[model samples]
Target chain A: MAHVISMLPVRNEAARWLRATLEQLSILTDRIVVFDDASADDTADFCKSYPKVRYYRGDIPWFEQNEAELRRHLWELATYENPEWILALDADELFEERATLELPWLLNQEDYDAVAFRIFDFWKGTEQVRIDGAWNPWNRFSPLLVRYDSTLSPDWMAQPIHCGRFPLSYRDRVTFYSHLRVQHFGWARGDEHLKKYLFYRERDLAVYGAVQSHTESVLSSSITLEPWIPMPSPGWFSEKEHR
Target chain B: MKKRIAILTSNHFEPSGARQVYGGAERYGVELTKLLLDMDCDVEWWQVGDNWNKEIIPGVPIRGVPETETPYQTMPHLNQVFFEQAVDADGAIYFVMYLAYPTVFPNSISISHGIYWDHPGMDKFLPSALDRQEWHRRLQLAIGGVRSVVSVDTATINWVRATWPILAQKFSYVPNFVDLNSFYPQNKESRSPHPRLRVVFPRRATTVRGINEAGKTALWLTESHTDLEFHFVGRAHDDNMERTLTTWASSHDRIFYYWLPPHLMAELYRFSDIVWIPTKSSEGTSLSCLEAMASGCAVITTAVGGLCDLIQDGYSGLLIEPTARALADATKRLASDPQLRERLGTHAREVAETFSLDRWHSRWSEVITRVF
Candidate 1:
């Protein structure tokens, strides 16, 4: 059997999409390690209650922590589980079927060191993925599903404040499995929607200061589906993949 | 009872490395005239530069007028000559290629291929700079007298209409379509194996085509994808372009080819996995891009001219700014993903089917009828 484990680093994700996101990953992998960054809510206690999830506490608060260092440490800590491959995840992300992506068969393949999945940034609800403006990663983003080879960890961190440090050395070895879609629910719900936007803006202001040039716009209610083109189906919900 | 039509061009249209050929406008003029003749419409083709007069087609005679002897002036007397020639023609239309007009007949349509002001610094080209001031006056002259204005893309028509609101009511959108039969996709299962993922650019060796930007993109893409190959297929316009590209090709092992005949051009498009057109301006429905789509190559182009009409960014194709960095980044995105390429190619082919030669003939016939 191919040994597969998942890694997640999150904070204050109590009422966010954490529970549903974990439930989805549970069916795909045997183990999960979530590093809780000092959540004020019962997030730490709630994650530990899951059958496959193992909760660990981060030293710093979520906002105070440097995302790159946190991501690198979490990635390194997960390798201690000694799994053949790791399914790296954010609390807000949900993996979807790639028509015929057999994870077991994929893990057994000797060719690739990492796999990059397409990310659909869901806004307002599960049905719509944000494709407007520069704030989003547009239509595609590659979060790593890396093999636990000692030399294979990414040297480069996710820039301008996202998660995961990507390695320049793994460029050729990385296979773009776009069918393995990830539905990002970071911007869709309650006050968490506006909070996430302000969180990034706050981070930007703290670093770049007053000259940040509008910090990119949030997905407004006015934004709707691209009526002319068919969008890739969000992985969170079992919506029919639009052709 | 076919309507008589006269088409005008400022340059001759032959393939690169032939007797003489220029840029996109020259090629487009040739293709349009040929297609019109194939429809059995009465056609008269006139060109400036050479005085040689001959009939390339049975009924259609190509009249070439010599450029008047003057420094930095090409066909200064064309305005008078074209007016006199059109007396015999039922209707005359001058193809407005560079926002520069050699001639504009009264009550005739002015079909713009490019807008000068839209692409800033384009007036600095040595040939165009000589008569740059003349273009503004001649354009204003054409706007008043011309029956209507036609543009190949909605963006260009909108720009023209916005710039000169006086011509707003007289503007129409008539895009040039592709030869779907000649350039088409074969079944993926039956194709021959390619050793490398081919990236082809069907752009001429000219500054406007963005060859230099394409060179930078190829260099940047090579670091990630060692098997990536870039093939440029078009005649070099000058010795300078040839020398520059030749030097770039020498530095890289993957850079290949100079140009291909139309038959071989079809094969190249079919063979390519990705197509890149670096042109920022002077594209009135880029035929090469349309042909690539028909041949099933996923295209990425600078978001300029008629490209915005064909591509929907990440959908059918990618539209980015005409910069080396932008081209390199977009190329890397498309080069890494096979599924994205396949999806985009499938959608692109569907788009090409909509603007097939039959549809082009329909649109062309209407323009001729309405203009006359």
Candidate 2:
């Protein structure tokens, strides 16, 4: 049996959708490593309530100011658990229900070092994902699940804004592009869209000297939306299937 | 100290005298400068011309950089030159979206009027598959380099998003607007009683504007309907096109060809019952269409570019394909039904309120405020 640990970098998300995220993550992993980035809300207490969650709060806010440093800290904390695999995710992201069934098979495999999944950006509500224009998130694969390797040192993109999740060296290793999807409800609410827009205007402009173009597109009214369709996990790791 | 802003464009003047190149893009540039001026920012306009400098308006100077054309397009050269010239400025604005290709300055924004390559004639511009591929590559670099983009229509935004989904966050849709006060409908009591139904084609005589189709449709409708009057109320690109239009108008009864200044166009729209904006390709949210809608004229426009954003198929105005036969059919239908015209005109005016100049100013000011 292999132990799988899920690491999450979260901020003031207690009042939003943090609990629902924790509830879903608890079902998939043996232990959940949560690094709260100086959240002002009851996120630390909420996360502490979970038996599987090992919660740690930063002394000062760092996610918006120094994302790479924060992610590096989260990575170090997750590695301390001696888990076979680490699943890096945001507080607003949730894996599909099929991921629970697929995770055991995925962990038992020795052919791949990492796994990538298509992400769906849910707009206005949880039932539908935005498919129009730049909202086509499913077209690109995000490497969220990676096998732990102690020999190779992880290098993060040292920018405060748009610093990617996972080590910069993750692409060098073989990665399986999994069919399982991640539902990102970060931009699901209308008010949250405005809040995010203003947040980027303040943080990105101050740090990067320019607000990212996608920040302006968050509030677009003329977007094409499609209902969320659940994809059945490929039974590659089942008893009947052989590599 | 006022924040200094430099704007790079292809053309604002006609490369010679102080005479401004009157077009939708030029109008947008002027309006954007005015807004920046109101925000107390020192603004300057740079364009490809024969090295001249003059003030287009009070407190705003327009300078011309020597024209340099490359095989790919003149855009990359213009962007590089503008970046060098505007280095001292606090920030920059790429007035034309394509001009930001290959590179752009930090703390800069770009403006996309609409999708200009949707026309069939784009083959002549790109010529080869390799040329188009290179063009697309440069365009992606241009868009990625800019901090933000202000798109006049959703058409260009959608195209960019579909082409490069990663760059979707860069665009903000801000459609063109009309001055409701200047372009209001005439009261029924004030309008002079006229027997003939007046139909106006108030657009520049250019191939992309669907002038040939409009001319054919106007001629057909005039010959068929005894009580219909067709008016061509815009300037031609050159003397040859003007001569062609004048000759066509001379041979037909109830047909008129004339040009009016921007201020006087309100009166022309007020008297007209139906407006035709049959643009074949390369369009944004047209100023002419918005003015017509604000003036309560039932607009019949082709579903090209941002025209779709302004006129819903049967709600505010009639939308059709850019063909002479389609234009003729829509015109004939409107000419026969006065009640339908009135209903569409009223709804158009109502829709025009949402795209008021005040709203446009507020939206644009918000975008510029973040950058500057």
- The top-ranked prediction according to TM-score is 2
C-alpha lDDT of residue B81 in model 1: 67
TM-score of 1: 0.55
Residue A68 CA displacement from its true place in model 1, Å: 81
True-vs-predicted CA distance for residue A203, candidate 2, Å: 71
lDDT (Cα, tens digit) per residue for candidate 2, span A16-102: 888878998888888999999888888988999999999888879997678889998899899999989889889999888767665
Candidate 2 wrong stretches, greater than 4 Å: A1-243, B68-70
Worst ten in a row by lDDT for model 1 chain A: A234-243
DockQ per candidate = 0.01, 0.00
- Maximum-lDDT candidate: 2
lDDT of 1 at B199: 88
Q: List the residue pairs that clash in candidate 1.
A: A157-A165
What Cα-based lDDT does every candidate model obtain?
A: 0.66, 0.80
> For all the candidates, what are their Cα RMSDs to the real structure?
23.3, 25.1
The total of clashing pairs for model 2 equals 4
